[model samples]
Target: MSPVSSFLWTYAVGVKVLLSQLLSRSFSLPVFPLQNGKVAIVTGGAKGIGYETAKHLSRLGMHVIIAGNHENQGELSVSRIVKETGNEKVEFMYLELASMQSIQQFVQHFKAKNLLLHVLVNNGYIRWPVNQCSPGAAAVMLVPQRNTADGFEEHFGVNYLGHFMLTHLLLDTLKQSGSHDLNSRIVTVSSATHYIGELNLNDLQSRHNYSPHGAYAQSKLALVLFSYQLQQRLAAEGSHVTSNVVDPGVVNTDLYKHTSWLFKLCKWLTSWLLFKTSTQGASTVIYAAVSPDLEGAGGSYYVNGQKVKSADISYDEDLQRKLWAQSCNLVGNPERHQCAS
Candidate 1:
């Protein structure tokens, strides 16, 4: 899209989000009993909504692993959470979503601990700028494309594919840890932008006509489809595991670090009336993670603390299967039984 078109499109989306934020009241998460001994892995837990979710889970007495690429930040966040929550079980683990090798090592390290896995929160993401230009500048100066360590589109790879591989690698442990009464859960962080997503199955890597907006949306939409598809498989197999997607309302976080100057200006002017804080945005994640109310419920798309329908295309069963199969090939799911470095 041209710079003018991109600006208009972004403005429209931003307006819609701000209007929704104004209309919707804060959702109060229902308090749940302490989840003693249960384990959870929250990717990108060192900051923003992920950090808040990890801290909340830790407060509930659950063993929380803050998985990310930044070792220093991860360790410090873990220490902070431990100190604040008084939960020594809170710790950090190295997991670089951009690299499958790092993901494998993360899983191996977790498995070596022989701990039970109750929740997996796929919450990390990066938003590259789409070259927001001035009125006097060219209308269509394409931002240089970004790729992951595996050569996939940056957004598609780190945000969606990384979590897909991680979930599959840990699926067995999640199943074994869950029971009929208290089912295991997988909560993926999706976005309202998913409604605008357009996925080209043939070009899952976004090798052509790449735009950060489209790439990010496509990745989030993929997560919704993956979550629903995984939910279906878990139910069909009678596994005591559930998979769900959560659209944390547009929260004030570094997720928007790549926004254009104008957008950032709007944010500063609004002073958070137009956006939810990270703590507020994490409500649905915590709700989906441990709420007994959601036990046994799978494939639910949660927003504003209520279950809602996702994008119309997300329900395409055939598309879901195709994406799943393609993702498996991309992530080497066929070799999941044995750890491959």
Candidate 2:
């Protein structure tokens, strides 16, 4: 077997083993009842695990807003969730992850409602493999070294900076919701590939030594670092907002559709072996958002619903702050605007 195939076969077997264990234990999920009238916004909620999470949250009685790249998909997801849960509280909004203008517009629309935001899920993402120059536009792939229109790396721009700006814009609403309970949260969706990433202070955008996967890993690592740093900043400033990061555990999602054919074949093999269901993949996110166990926890990294030690690189305080600074610079928020301010 090819190395990729071998890996996939091993992964598939692992999944079966894990599933057997899960099924045998009669494991019951903990229920977290929403106390106040909570509102949640889930970016990229139109499909895959994000959609599952929105549906799950709606069933728990929280009003959910699905922010999607396409208006049609957003409407469809919202309609499905409302139909499934028999709740009219779910809604949809348009958000193009690639454009800062769209993000600003979405936030402005939310602000007009004067509603408090109890939870924010940074889940929108894309993974194109390489550049495809077309008429009047440069469509860069998700490779390690490429510049976005904003001049930051592509992965960094979408996965980290976009959410960074969105979170900043919605900070006031989060604070308003948490003033009553002090448990408001920012749940950042990261990935396990982060362990392989390293910080090259000299080339944060991978201008010289760019590898798409490597750059993507760096972005995810930065996300974990950002989560920790934000928590510390809030604590230092004596703010009540909590920030935590989680890895959904590999599942079959469209997040990888842009990968090369070789990668896709490998993924298919492994998914047939050890992949998670969309609902299972979303469990950690739900836990972070609602589980009383995390009521006051902040700056922690979670996987599959349990808090665990992250990769060593994820803890480098100097790196975390540096990454934050760079992210701020890239997003045009160089002043490091306080999320709770």
Candidate 3:
């Protein structure tokens, strides 16, 4: 982890993303059939790649619900998409991914509407800087280690657990929509950083050895593991619901807003050269969600609209099952039959 090594690693990742984008440009996405009555939900849909994703789905005639914590941004995203797509079905719903209560409330509200959910895209994310300071303070300090309302590490809680709970709560609705047409999909946004992540089952919350980058990697690795497990469960039950993970290659998004100034400067210097636009970053997500070519595919990892091999560790069945059980326990649903052996 020397400075030079870090810079090299960053450069390599940037190159990989740029290559994926270039390769992706040669392919065209298949036109999804009319989705006039289908319902889709995109978390973190207020801005960046998520907003672009919401816009794409809305253009296909699906009723899209943009879920996020910011009321103003969420409403504005909805307005923009509606205006741009001329699809009035676009709307916004409040969601706070760090709070278990908020997730439950949002699910309840959606269920009360009696809507069948055809797509659930877990795209929200949070990344803490390597350092920070309290409001109005002149002194800077290492970012304090924190946990979510549910007592899990902040990154793991919001990035993986919250989405886990949301998906679990909406399982029935997703199944309902898939039962007839086999088009229901659950898309989880993951990252290439998962390759460097190691699952510490003993310290699931990173109580002892917590670094910002390590924690973020662990969260994304957990997401990929969850996606695979979910697909297995759906197939085991003979359900039509498909679950897949996507790597939206190196997008210039708000996920980096809290990084150090040095990091920001480096990124700004290379922005145009290395970073993918939000639209490009969102293309893989859109592909995973509605691609007719992936009609029956599950437990697959996709990048730039193509199936790619994930890190070797990501394919370990024991690790995937262990994470699945641990996540269910953390979410307070240990007795749920879906998680039973």
Candidate 4:
């Protein structure tokens, strides 16, 4: 997209987000008073909106487990939340989404705890410089082609595939929890950038053509697609575990740490003018996880605690199905084993 076009599109989306927040301000988020027995796992809960999300969920009296790669930061986050919320159930578990082995290990450890999971928040992401190795490379060359330890594109692997595996691995527990209350949920944190992404099923990792923005957007789109598809499968199997996506509008977070100095300066200058606070950005996630109005509501996109229509492409069932099949294959689900309830 051209500079002017990009700017205008961003401005329009920002206005819409602000309006949504304004309209929903009077709607008080429901508090879960009987959440003492419930459990929630939030990925990337060490910092940014994820940290705030973990804090909020713990405040509701739920047993919250924060999974992230940073050991010290994760422990610190767990300590702070426990001190603030006085919910000692909050704990941190090590997880590196860039590696399949790490995701499996984390899931295995959680399962060994023998706790029923009421919510799974897939909220972690990374944004690296597309051409950090060759800073002077051309635009195409600047596209991030880096792969994860699993040999998948870094963004795709961490943002979409890893969560995909984690969710499937824990599906049984989520279903077991829902058997008692029918309110278990899987909340996938997506972004408005999904609208700008072009899903190339043939080249999901972007081996042939790549752009940093395109790869990031594609990962988010894949997340939404997975959310919808998962919801559909759950419904078809007569399960009550709902799956939904959230867009935390333009928050100033560490996700942009890899940006250029010029971009950083510009963001600092416009931070208050454009960005949402981490707490504000996390509100939608909390809403999706516990909102009474959303009980059993699946396959929806939410912003600022309200159900909102997603990008045009997000409604394409064919695209959603294709992405789901490809994701299963990439994750080694060759037989397409139905996720156990």
Per-candidate Cα lDDT values, in order, are 0.82, 0.73, 0.78, 0.78
lDDT of 2 by residue, 195-295 (tens): 65666767777776466666666677778888898888877866667999988876677766445676678667766655677787788888888887887
Q: Candidate 1's residue-wise lDDT over 1-341, tens digit each?
A: 43345446656766797798889798898879999989999988888899999999999999999887666677888999999999999889888777899889999999999999999999854322224322121110122467767898877888889898899889999999999999999999988777777778998887776677777768878999888888888898899999999988878876555667887798888846878999999999999999988989989899889999889999999999898888988887634542221
Best by lDDT: 1
Of the candidates shown, which would achieve the greatest TM-score relative to the real structure? 1
Off by over 4 Å in 4: 1-32, 126-143, 260-262, 334-336, 339-341
lDDT of 4 at 306: 75
- TM-scores, all models, native as reference: 0.91, 0.84, 0.89, 0.87
- Position 295, candidate 4: lDDT: 85
RMSD of 2: 5.5
Which lDDT tens digits does candidate 4 get at residues 1-341?
Answer: 43345344544554565555445552345665556788999998878888999999999999999987766667888999999999999999988787888888998899999999999999855322233432121211113468878899877888888899888888888988896355799999998877766688888987875656667677888889889988988898888699999998877777665444655686688777656788888988999888777888889998767788988888888888888877777877722466322
Q: Please list all clashing residue pairs in model 1, or write none if there are none.
A: none
What C-alpha lDDT, on a 0 to 100 scale, does residue 128 get in candidate 1?
22
Tell how far residue 222 is off in model 3, in angstroms: 0.5
* Model 2 CA lDDT for position 124: 42
Q: Arrange candidates, best TM-score first.
A: 1, 3, 4, 2
Q: In model 2, where do residues sit more than 4 Å from their true spots? A: 1-28, 124-146, 180-182, 260-263, 334-341
N/CA/C clash count, model 4: 0
Model 3, span 242-320: residue lDDT tens: 9999998878776665456766786788777667888878888988888777887889998877899997888888999
Q: What's model 1's lDDT at 303?
A: 89
